[model samples]
Target: MNCPLISLKAGAVIFTVLWTAWMMWWSGAYSTANLVILAVCGAAVGYVWYRAMRWQFERMGMLPHKDDRSAQ
Candidate 1:
């Protein structure tokens, strides 16, 4: 498991979510209620993005785990 790589990915996702939410709020010109919805959706997107990256990295043999050695 590469801790640095994982942290980098997480940081990127967080940055993306923050930037996206701000852009949505600034550009959508929506009401407070709608902005709340956007925030929720942005969170979901970030979670999915993070999971997808983790899955991809695992598949690519980039993510390591102590148990993985026993499996092989």
Candidate 2:
């Protein structure tokens, strides 16, 4: 619940679907280009989600490290 990564992942999925639907509707047709854009968006979202998860884990003292072991 405290992890932002989960929320971000959900957002990515929700937005990707919405964006893809909007784009598809606007174009009035589907094509390879649209699929490529969708892929790019998904990838970008995935990257952001990964970074956010790392940051959140670090902030929450959930990241693993020898030094961290002493702190806890």
TM-score of model 2 vs. true structure: 0.49
lDDT of 2 by residue, 1-72 (tens): 334546656776776677666666777756788778866876676567667766677777676544665787
Backbone clashes in model 1, listed as residue pairs: none
- What is the lDDT of every predicted structure here? 0.72, 0.66
Question: Top TM-score: which candidate number?
Answer: 1
Candidate 2 Cα errors over 4 Å, as ranges: 1-29, 65-72
Worst 10 residues of 2 by lDDT: 1-10
What TM-score should be assigned to candidate 1? 0.65
Q: What overall lDDT, based on C-alpha atoms, would model 1 receive against the true structure?
A: 0.72
lDDT of 1 by residue, 3-63 (tens): 8566957776786679667868687678787777777777777777777776777677777
- Deviating ranges (above 4 Å) for candidate 1: 1-9, 12-16, 22-27, 65-72
Tell me the lDDT of candidate 2. Answer: 0.66
